[model samples]
Target: MVPHQCLGSVWSRRNRPGNEHVAPTVRATIAQFNVVASCIITTCLGDPSMTAQDRAVVVGHWIRVAKACQILGNYSSLRAILEALQSVSIHCLQRTWDNVSRKSF
Candidate 1:
């Protein structure tokens, strides 16, 4: 096991913007993150009666979210985006500062 943190290592995508690859990566990251976050956050915010398996599922789900957020963007409002990201519990998905996600698109 890579400690669940290695998956969040930022992938350096070069020339992606010029090739229109950036948009899809961003969109995919957001979409995937949203989906995984929904599952994990829902179970997490739900009853304390959740089983150990449910908690494990949430932990794995958050790892997916972290990996998605690891896909970086080179837009102008990076600072604002980062701040906004901090507002969400998804920030814990990465378990480290391995990703620099934006709050604002």
Candidate 2:
């Protein structure tokens, strides 16, 4: 999935084939999961072995989680997403944008 648009797509996919438990408790669990997931992604992005494309993939996953939490109607989760997004380096955002800007596939 595309980096910037990853979340919306993930949410849409989840809406179609979601776990029954994943939906109802999603609102309640989203905030904590978002933070944990964001931290993990942030750490992954910082791995010295990861390439630019790999970093972009990690950022895309964070975007997906953010989108999912937002669509779940969890305000705390949304806040966490905002914080995570801020924590993401500007270079990462630019890389995501660059990836998007050049897509012809």
Candidate 3:
């Protein structure tokens, strides 16, 4: 038998009826994270005139999104967004980040 079928059979045996809701919740959470990740990367990379303050604001917004992902138990999205933020940091204006509050970091 195929591995997929084997796994499904095992999963079905252990699964409860009401747990069917998990798939849709997971799908929606992933979709939301995808959009958020796209927006964060685009906003940071596309704008050359972005000030340090601007960068801090962007990072702050992403931090909030990451927190939401954590609360929702969506590790995939949280990791993706955090990585994207780290990737974009190399391009960020240093002086602006210095001025930002520590809590945002």
Candidate 4:
């Protein structure tokens, strides 16, 4: 998602109660799960062309997003993000994961 558009839209939706411009809670949860899963698969395994260093960078970005979700009290997104991080596909990349700092785990 584009940074300004997605975040700006979510912020705007927070002000209006009746308008259905955004997704409902369940749909949002499913969407978040799908997004995180896609990120995990693509970043960790899908791109044979992408360097391990590049994938690690993408994973780090997701970790930051997860932390932001936690701080915002968005547990569903946080849970989905965490599950993506914990997936076996990501874990299978030992070299990529080794680049992650010990404190991050």
* Winning candidate number (lDDT): 4
Q: Model 2: residues >4 Å from true position, as ranges?
A: 1-41, 88-93, 100-105
Lowest lDDT 10-residue stretch of candidate 2: 96-105
Candidate 2 C-alpha lDDT tens digits along 2-64: 343335544454445544333344444565757664675466555777765676666566567
- Superpose all Cα atoms of candidate 2 onto the true structure and report the RMSD in Å to 1 decimal: 13.5
Over 4 Å off, model 1: 1-42, 72-105
Show pairs that collide, candidate 4.
none
**How accurate locally, in lDDT, is each candidate?**
0.45, 0.56, 0.69, 0.72
For each candidate, what TM-score against the reference? 0.29, 0.47, 0.56, 0.62
Best by TM-score: 4
CA shift at 71, candidate 1, in angstroms?
A: 1.7
The better-scoring model by TM-score among 2 and 4 is: 4
Q: Give residue 61's error in model 4 in angstroms.
A: 0.7
lDDT of 4: 0.72
Model 4: per-residue Cα lDDT at residue 39: 67
Candidate 2 has an lDDT of 0.56
Better of 1 and 4 by lDDT: 4
lDDT leaderboard ranking: 4, 3, 2, 1
For residues 44-85, write the lDDT of model 4, one tens digit per residue: 667788777877877777788788889999887788778877
For model 4, the run of ten residues with the poorest summed lDDT: 1-10
RMSD of each: 14.7, 13.5, 8.6, 9.5
